[model samples]
Target: MFIFVGCAGGGTSSMFCQRIAKAINATDPNLTATFGGVNEVLADPIACIGDHDLMFAYGSIDVVRGYSAFDFGQLFDAILVAPQVKYLTVTKQKIMANYPTIVEDIPSEIFGKMNGEVAFEELRGELIMLDLLRGYQSSLQTASKNADKDIEILVLNADHRNQQLAKVFANWQRYGIRVLTETYTLEGLYQFDPPADFELRLLFGATMQLNQQDFVRISRRIDGLIVFSETPKTAFRDWRQQLDDADIPTAILDARMLEKRADVTQLSAKLTDFIQTVEFQAEATAGQIRLPKLQTKKAKKQHTLFGIISWNSTIK
Candidate 1:
């Protein structure tokens, strides 16, 4: 079986596709998986839909909410017309649930005016109609394309951000990127050794309050820091000073900047430059580098709930 997974962005969704491919490949030697950004897939819907046995649509809740019934009809119809597709799976709710930071951060007023159940049913109805129309259109598009194939359409209503995060971490591990925390001790660090040819070394940390002493210790090993924009400018200033004192570089990223597709592309370019500069500086000061040996401890992992959706239909 050949599967094509399309996501809204390259960061989280790309990571999720990698994990799905890994898990599927491990269990089924006969199956293969590939992934791309959703816009890329939509640009040539005919080829994308016709070539894959299964097409997985991964999007945030905002994607669904932003689309009107008519717009969704066209999208749903396009996918349904693909003769080779046996399954059409949507994992939006799962995506929202996986990202607690996104959920909890949402204002209550946003939910106050809407009825959740009613909205969901309306969306589901639109999707079902699209499926029916696709079945009707299939015969006109391709005479030999699996007219008897069973097609399944499923929409899962559960959290998904955590699953995406798991994929992100897994990818980081595969690429040798170490994940560390703001904890003062060294043992609290989670490290990934990048490939020997990898040029940049980075450390990602998040905290409500950054300790200067801890920052000093972490800067010893990492060439730079990943700081979120949500952090106060005052805290960022202190962290910057500490990093500068230790001769380490810093990149301040806004988590919200990812909401817009265009911003995501721009951010990717900026990050690439930031990483290259830090790596160059680190290489120049290689002889003077001295890593600290702070105490180590096992990091505790958090657990969360996830949901799955599946559907089936006989091709006419």
Candidate 2:
């Protein structure tokens, strides 16, 4: 089989190709391997599809499948190849520094030809997993584009600074999902520029302490909610009670019993699944909505409506 090994840049792929080719060619002279930068190789469909039989794709295979020359009917397959497993310790450390979430437990050095084959085989699984994640991201993008209504989400946090959550928000935004991250402070609610519209809001963090008035205000803003139970504040309990009473579509994340906070991956996956499955219909007005205060009995009777729709009448 003809295989093309690629990396972010052509340099690493060259070394990998040399080693892989030497190992495979020793056994079967018919099998060949080549190297190139991933973008350059994937961009030129003629060279990639005409000369090579298979591509050792790193992430989502959508790009390869999109190739016009690719024949799906033929014996074609996308194989995932991870080069990190065979990397030197120093190189791995540098990679981990940038990608703190990417953790590889297995340690194997490819010293001999046999070791190279074994390491490559083990690394294949990692590539496949990466492909699956990329596929998930692609699905989100497609769904967002095709959705009749804009999909926007609010991420509530007590702490404003969380690198992991920021990355997750950024990823969702890249997939065409509008994200608004906010934190509750003594000063009041603080958030960056929010989306123009949102039908769904999700609440998290320990200090999102809400009073009865605060609860009523939020109920008007969101149609669906995913509430966490581990928070020490009674406001979370109150919020859940209100949502349950209103019969709103809500998902409860019970982390009360856990000894520690849930890691970023676990929480992000849960949020993603919830977003994908639920259909939100509540119409949140696209500006500041405030309930006008009523001082007199006549005013209370006249104010039958709530939010921006509320208006006053002339007694004439």
**Which candidate comes out best when scored by TM-score?**
2
Q: What are the lDDT scores of the predictions, listed in order?
A: 0.35, 0.38
On the 0 to 100 scale, the lDDT of residue 313 in model 1 is 15
Q: Which ten residues in a row have the lowest lDDT in candidate 2?
A: 294-303
Q: After aligning candidate 2 to the native by TM-score, how far in Å is the CA of 34 from where it should be?
A: 89
Q: What is the lDDT of residue 229 in candidate 2?
A: 55
The list of candidate 2 runs beyond 4 A from truth reads 1-160, 185-208, 229-239, 254-264, 277-279, 283-316
Could you tell me how far off, in angstroms, the CA of residue 122 lies in candidate 2 after the best superposition? 88
Which lDDT tens digits does candidate 1 get at residues 245-267? 66666666555544433344455
